[model samples]
Target: MTLLAGARVFDPETGETTRADVRLDGERIAEVGPGLDGDQRVDCSGGLLIPGLIDCHVHVAFRRPEPLPRSARILEAVPVLRGLLARGITTVRDAWGADAGFKHALAQGWISGPDLLVSLRQLGPTGGLGDTWDPAAGAVDNYGDPSLPDPLFDGPDAARAAVRRMVRAGADWIKVGASGSMRAVRAGVDVRPTDAELAAVVDEAGRCGRDVLAHAHTSAAVVSAARAGARSIEHGTFLEDDAVAALANAWYVPTLSPMSDTEFAGTHRRSLRLAVEAGVRIAAGSDLAPRPHVDLTTELRLLAAVLGDAAALKAATSEAARLLRLDGDRGRIESGLRADLVLLDGTDLDVTDLPGRVRAVWHDGERAGALTSP
Candidate 1:
């Protein structure tokens, strides 16, 4: 048993932030109150304790500019996960790049990492951004290349087959590319899958008892994917007022915070503000690919710049967990949930000052030391 005392516990779900003690038994939180008894006690005086952060979108094997060597990419996964753990991210929904073997390795204790929920490889139509061939440039490559292995499909039948392949490969969820991507190859093409194709992927995933996360950038594509029953929209970078209204009753994850530093910030900021005002369930996702380290606080800081500090924290903790369907098991400083928590050194949740405040991190009731400067 362990006790974390004299800290302000932030529970976003209940809107409670009070000075309290949290007791842990093994990997789960045993109790939370003013004072708790435990065999071991840690002084958390003058600190803030909250649920461990969650990054809803990440690509573990991705490398920027050029793909890394296969062996290097594989070896990097452990340290990447460790970086996330060190930053107080105990759970991550790997949107792409994790294969069945990699996930199994993490699950079997062969790799020390977060609780990984992966959507095998992203599924997309031929000539799509996820596809290997560049139609305009007349360049061609195999879809299964180590550098770009996100499965490509040609039609409804192929989409169904690809989803089944992912399920057979032991995927926890399905990822479908419903629209074009600005960062991937074929940047400006409208790669939205046909409505029938979108339905086929969703149906196939439903048959396998899994939810689908759709990668969408355009307003039309976002609405189509939402209507097709996609569990979440990965980017929603161009969401408009009408599009936001369309997703008012559904879950949408805007991965725009990380891209705020890019050239597209002006256009994306207006769209994001509309989406937030429309009450579309906003969740935090770093879209942290190829960085070797996943930084939720950085993502949160960007979110606070766009939204506010309270909304940014909610997006990372409770809101993101709800979108990932892990709210019950994590995401709150409550009893019976996993004791994955983060202890910041300061009282103010200031976005500009977050880098200096992340003093320590805790994962599954075990303390990990301070975060290194970037």
Candidate 2:
């Protein structure tokens, strides 16, 4: 048993802070109150204890432009996995390109990484995002890791088969392309999966006890995906009022980092404001490829620009867990929950530049990572 003493716990839900000592037993939080007793007490004075951060969308094994071998590509992501945990992210949901082997390696202590919930690959229409067919060369792009199966389909039956294939490949959730890229739509080459196909994918994933994450950027796509029973919309970039109404029972993950410099930056900001005003549950995702870096703080800071600091913090912590269906297991700093917590050096609750202030991290009641400086 261990006790984290003297830190003030910040509740993401109510935006309240309470001075308490959190007791840890094995892998769960045993108690949260004043002066909790434990065999060993770790000094946490002048610190703030909050739930460990979660990133709802990440592609750790994303293919880079340089075209490396499959083993080299996967090895390149090892440091990224370690970096994510060092930045205080205890859990992550890989949208695509990471297979079940990555998760197993982490569990078996062969690699250090955030607890992973992997989609393995994303399904889409023939000419959509996951399709690698090259008509000019009459060959498919097989540069990606073989662990990720082909992700192309045409009709509803093919879509259902694609979902089943992913489940068999060890997908925790099914990700489908509900719409084409913005550039494709602007170029008048949009080719989204049919409504029937989207519904069939959702139904098949549901039969496997999994939820669906729909990659949608347009308002029409958002409505269609929500109506098709998608649990979350990936990039609601062009979200409108009617689309917000369609997401009454769904989540919205606006991956703002990748769109910060695009021409549609202002439009994406407006969509986020609309979703916020409409009371939509919003989660922050970086949508970063492997080259630059895996940083969720940028997304959280962007969210802070729309939502206040406290609420923005919640978007990455408690709210992100809720989006991943892990609220009861490891979201808040409550008793009887997994002891996935981050201890910040400062006593105050300013989440701006959160990663810089990380002093130590605990995942499942064990000291996972710590910074050399605060």
Pick by lDDT: which candidate is best?
2
True-vs-predicted CA distance for residue 92, candidate 1, Å: 0.7
Off by over 4 Å in 1: 134-150, 183-188, 290-294, 353-355, 369-374
Scanning candidate 2 in windows of ten residues, the lowest lDDT window is: 365-374
lDDT string for model 1 (1-374, tens) is 99998889887765557889999998899999986888998888988887888888887765334655556656767777766777777888888777666768876878666778888678888767566565575655433444334477888898899888888777888998888676642356576689899899999999999999998888888888888889888777788766787786567777765666777777777777888777778888888773444366667777787788877888888888888888888988889998888887865566565546666777777776554432
Q: How many clashes show up per model?
A: 0, 0
lDDT of 2 by residue, 248-310 (tens): 899999998888888999999999999999999988777767357647877888888888888
lDDT value for model 1: 0.77
Error of 2 at 259 (Å): 0.8
lDDT of 2 at 305: 85
**TM-scores for all predictions:** 0.91, 0.96
